[model samples]
Target: MNDTPITLSRADSSPPRSRSATWLSLGIGALVTLVALYLIVRSVNFELTLLAIRSANLWLVLAALGVQLAAMLFVIRRWQILLRPYPTRYNELTQIYFSAHLLNTILPAKMGTLARILLAAEMENLNVGFVFGSIAIEKVLDSLVMLLLLAVIAPFVPMPEWLRETVTASVLLVLLLLLLLVSVARFRSALLNAVTRFETRLFGAQSTRLALLVRGVIESLMNLTRRRELASVLFWTVCAILAGGLVNQLLFAALDISVPWSATWFVMVVLQIGTRVPALPANLGVFHYVVILALSVYSVNENTALAYAILLHLVVFVLPALIGALCALPISARLFALLTNRTQPTTE
Candidate 1:
């Protein structure tokens, strides 16, 4: 009998279907990238785009990079808050965060998230499900902050009809998720009892480990929802979003493009929502397309907008990857080993 806990068992279970699905997703993403690149290439003057990028103010670009780092710090702080009572060391956590950032950049489908959850769990000797739950709460807080920012800016900015509808849909979807999580957290004990009963009745005592894993996840969520933790996480989330907006503004300045702060905020919001779609690693063509779309409303030329998008991707994705490599190469190696089933995670 393999007495490994359910978390490790599930993490190591990579059946043929899963491999096929990952390849299929990558193929689809590549096709999307080619199509988007085609459209962009047809619309923009390549020379002009190169010239715009070349002419960008180097000093402002540096400033934007600095702000981007600050934004990442805010994100790390929010995650720290979610990881209450974990006793995670600041330096170690920072490395893990950026290492995950690097994985997120190169891997398709945000696999970096899983890496972070696993690494954090191992580092803190914590339950894998609990770490997963904390990350879930982090995502929920981000969605709420983005929606709030969109609402505050939409009234002042001239947004496209499609974007407005997307925002509306997003608001409803996030609210629904938030409500569901809250309900689960509120009645976690009862939920656990129900799960155990169902599993026992269906599969006998052998299946109870799954119930225990679910209980860990639910308890983590409940811990995160306590008033003090929620408030601190919310505050850091707002700071992170605002810091991201500032990076956008700085990038705009770098390009010497004069646009309202509202437009910058709107573009940030669009990028956030757009990148959530499964795409080539680091969002590739999708990032440029949405940036161009958002800037079009403000009459920014396609070439210049592409320049901005390229620079933005560098600061947002490439720089972080470099930092992560420098700081967390060993951790990343372990993450890949775990994913490949080269090594199993130790049972908690």
Candidate 2:
């Protein structure tokens, strides 16, 4: 008798356990922040760290920011390629991409990612599942590039246990996801049928809608395997990763942290992969922890190392977030409406 669409709203999609999990994640993030801050305060001479920051070349810092901002363009292009079926404008995607970065920095639980997916879906008249799927593909590509860098750097550098475990876990996760995609492609019909039957037994009357949503998600996963799309996506992804490494190297130079070029990969790898764990907004304590740990491997002192990490976080997270917020203001009304509106559902 009821015919309302199933929206991905907190009340509809998220069960009690999911809400509990979110609270638990927040608690973990808070604890991590406290521990990081405690360690930093105990180990580093705050005055000396401040002096190191003050002594940093202002022009070089600005140049580092510039390089990081430039790298975001390649990232946006890669995102656009993944979103081929929906076909968004270059300028619009740029705005959305950076806006998501702003959200990711300020919000917890990767909500920035969710923000972009929803924003793109709303703006482009596309299914949310499709957009989400594209984002997942982007993440997979990022993991592959990160793993490649680790492979290249592992032989020469004495990797820390944390770094080794992170890489191993990442590699296994990527492999599993790739295998899952292939399996779905090979047995699409059978998988869809199984999903439909499960939904039918679970939701009864709402099974039709749920089945359609599931099918869309599965199809989007399969789309990543298409040769042309995969090739283009991977190429841009690699470019983005290299550009990121360049940004880190420039930042290292700006802060006067002299290390080998490959050391940048170490910094990039840990920051990129380590922050994947639950942490405070903008990766807070987690970012500094990983950066200091990575730099320590190259014999950098705690005071100067913390300075580099703090400045790098500012360039990577804070400045871009500020710029992104400014650029996204014009479109904020629609984005806010989409996020807040509860009764209406965009169809699959």
Candidate 3:
């Protein structure tokens, strides 16, 4: 394993967005959350919602929670598969995964991915760009899996025109990304040489490091084309999706609700897409709104749907967050110190 300390560009150390922009985003997200909550309150009978919650089967709820954790494990395994070239231990990846999850819940705009890239690179003494590339590959694969799930359910469910359009756009985007990765991997040597020559002409002495970083990133992307790794990653991705579906199924069972498997899958897909939006910590109101909307299609009562959404959120979001917080505690101080030092301006 390389023991060299990772060097980050100034761009990496600092916030990508300005403070004012971040504040504006937070304000908008808060407004959206409030609006969603207001709509939910207006539509649901709180007393009935509470009664539904109160009467839920505890064992099924516990089972759903357990399945949610299993889903997280599948995600970790998929990431581990991507980092197969690196000297990574499963236990170390578990800590980093959960810690990133903790940050994702609190941070807006999926900043948890950035945190994961930094934490994984720093802890494992790996190249920062390589870690970033692995995450990129992971996301592309996830998008493909989600699209596949949507395709499977399309025949059974009458998707709204808007959803069909969104899926069409997503399919095009994922295809473009996949093509780019394949092209990069196929011509990695030529691309690296070109990058090195360009950087050398522009930056002179500092060119080598930049070239090496690019090489690391290219190598990471190359993993996608490897048949064995691709197959393994796909398997894990499917497993994670299945595990998530089971969690949804268990939650429905807990509420004493009977919905077709396709309905459950639809809800799962909607939740996946919905929670990706910029929102309050842990997705708060946005999550519940999406769940209720998805459940509404099946003629589920507003109160019952609300009850289901709240419980599902607790299991799928809150529980992971709590576990992630615990996992992050040991590394929190070190991570903070590293970021602080990196953010400080270097003196000549």
Candidate 4:
């Protein structure tokens, strides 16, 4: 049997807000990007950066590109496995995944995930909560794997004071995430009840549909904790993490920079944590800065590190985004139609 479908429009998902607030968000995002770009331009020598890019090993660079694509495939497979017990077309999901990824690389504050979730729910007629629940589970698994890898490799890497602080910060972040998951899992009913009362009071008659969506989301979260499916989710997530590390190592080789394969975990950790900081579109300056900092810990030259960061980010961000845009065009049209036709006012 197919999974039950849940329909949602923007009106159902987002609380009504003012246009001025939307403009404020865009203005802030634009300001952040401009500042980040200014900092990057000041720091790197354009001539030297261009020279470094030209010097990269083309064969290894191509191989690195291949590795990045494979890594994405692994992640999508993991998502596929997570969405199991709910049948979905593999090809359709792949398109949505890539399209969502493209938007994510371009947009700030991770709107890509929600865009994909809403698009997928609209197209597949799947429950929004189920799709979102799978993504949430993916995040939890990613955090745990990061912590485990760090612990296993910490002894080998020298414990400089700065490194120690970074490790500590990462640990705290993981723990905080874990605590949040536990709280939600344990107290879902209370949380849902509180939110439901607020929505009903605020939205009046419109609250009935919104309350149902809230219930669907909470139920999906609860259902995902079931042991059989959870195991598959965990296993595939590990593959995705390992695949990420491989992408880092391949990019290192592509740049002809020597670092221990294990050290790539440090690169992976730093890169992930760094990008989490709010930045302009495509993670421009933030990605390069964190990569250079991570490699500098191992005594890599700043120019070479900058080159590596630039090439890797280009391959990682650009290629998929271009391809995903092509895939998303038709899908996005359908989503647009759904948004226009299905949205209704809260009072109605």
Candidate 5:
């Protein structure tokens, strides 16, 4: 049984807003990029900075990249496993990694989840439900994993109560949201009934659209239960996040900076926490300011935090373009456009 939900018209959907949004997102991202570069320059002596990468431990660089790549690979596998109830191509997983990262590099977001789903759905002729659900799972698990690590450091890190409270609020908010999803998934029919009734109350017969949405949600939940291949996906996600924590620790170490593990974890969590919020693409001005602020609690000098943020951002950001460009080599590269336009096939 194919569990993916069929999307009828994706091509006509040119980002809901306008061309202006595209331009705005680009401008925001570019501005952020410049600010980050400026910080790197300010952080160290000009001549010394240039020589640092040359003189910096190449092993640390490779280690960081390797850990990140491993995380991406596991993410791909997780997505594929989620699509298990339906037909899928595991080899195609790389395309998702590439395209998602491509959008991140050029657009906002740590990854282009929407683009990733469109690409996979079109290529496999499957629906988007499983993919969408899997992405949700990724977000939840990533947050949980990050929070779990922070929990360990909480007792050790000497930060303001407000910071601790904020993290707690963030974690709890996310947990509540996921709990809601799990609840709806478990009691889908009741939720659907409520949705239908609510629509009837609002739009009467026009509630057809809302009714359909409820149906879709129910179908998504059903698809998820078809198989559980990636129980280990969550397992590996925890490992990957831990590995990332270590990478940050090493980064500080190589720079001759000493931050308690808890402090560094807090910094890592905060840097990513900001990106998750919807903002201009590539997470422009927000990413930098947040990173700098997050690190300040650790008594980390602004210069070092700024420099770390710049390089760290690029490691996850620019690095993908290389891989995305490579993945684009396949014939399947056009998959997303095709999926988007599936409702109205373009005439040659």
Candidate 6:
């Protein structure tokens, strides 16, 4: 019997997939750099030097980072809360730090999703299929909640035609996803049996594995099936969303610019969705490109917009990354774990 911990097959041939993702991501990055440069050069205030760091809204930016951090803390707490019924010991903040942004920088696709799943699986020595199914459920819930917040804040802003269309389509997509999950939950047994039947007809041992995977997904969904549990998670989620909105608002506030609260929500939603489209490391170029595009359409001045976009990203990106590294290495030799987690791209 293998008593010591055994690492799973790390020879994930997923590197081939990552190689393709990298080239595509790099292209976006290059385009982003071009766009940012264009905006900076053409801006009406190109002659204006940046405000000294001392004179700028240092307190407000720090406060914004604090709010963002707290919002993430709440999300971690919410995840821990949701898993209360399960046997799991996730550190509220540490997991979120590593799972959301840190792994986001390092992983490909939705490796942050996989990171949390892998961490949970390792810590509890649980089934990968079941743990990962929880991740899928979590992702769906996250998308739906963000869209719901976006919808609620929509009425407060004068949205441009482009954003309005995007939001409308996204809302429908979110609805479709929610309905699909509900249908699966309703007909889980039939779905499972059908999948098992199909698998058995095809690959024998592989079908057995597929059936197990199906069961795990279904079981994870079952964990959230209770109205009480769902409601509890939603309550905390609502708080986090509000906190996130504040962070977005403060991002603009730090620029000495005022956008409608609705605009803040819009930017946050846009940035979250935009960056996921396979950008370069740290979203290097694309971050400025998307934010500038979004703000320009909103009639924000180009110079102020570029300044706001880059500065806000620095706060949100670099600060969290540094903190994530520190937190991961605070006590344990997880410094290597952080390096392992940070250097390697995520496997969604």
What would the per-residue lDDT of candidate 2 be over residues 247-268, giving only the tens digit for each residue? 7887788878899877989888
Model 2 lDDT on a 0 to 1 scale:
0.77
lDDT (Cα atoms) of all candidates against the true structure: 0.79, 0.77, 0.80, 0.72, 0.62, 0.63
Arranged by lDDT with the best first, the candidates are 3, 1, 2, 4, 6, 5
lDDT of 1 by residue, 8-111 (tens): 34343222227777888888888888888888989999899999999999999999899999989988888777766556677777888998888788888677
Where's the lowest-lDDT run of ten residues in candidate 4?
Answer: 339-348
Model 4 per-residue lDDT tens digits across residues 1-348: 125555565566655445576466556766765776676677777788788789888887777777778778777877777666666777888898888888778765565786777776766666666677668767767767877887788777764576567668878877886676566678877877887788889878555665666655665555456787667666766776776777777778777789876678988877766666566667877788778778877888777888988887887898889988998887776655443445453332
Model 6 error, position 340 (Å): 9.4
Per-candidate TM vs. native? 0.92, 0.90, 0.89, 0.85, 0.77, 0.79
Give candidate 5's error at residue 194 in angstroms: 5.7
Better of 3 and 4 by TM-score: 3
lDDT of candidate 2 at residue 224, scale 0 to 100: 70
lDDT of 3 by residue, 201-275 (tens): 987955466675776678778787789998999899889988989988988988899888898789888776666
Better candidate number, 1 or 5, judged by lDDT: 1
- The window of 10 residues in a row where model 5 has the poorest summed lDDT is 8-17
lDDT score for residue 268 of model 2: 87
Extract clashing residue pairs from model 6: 106-345, 107-345, 107-346, 108-346
lDDT tens digits, residues 139-250, model 5?
A: 7767777777677776777656656667777888788966765676568778768877887899786534545534544554454444454455656666677666766766
Judged by TM-score, which candidate is best? 1
User: What residue pairs clash in candidate 2, if any at all?
Assistant: none
lDDT-wise, the better of 2 and 4 is 2
Error of 5 at 137 (Å): 1.9
Which candidate do you rate higher for TM-score, 1 or 3?
A: 1
lDDT of 6 at 252: 76
lDDT score of residue 306 within candidate 2: 95
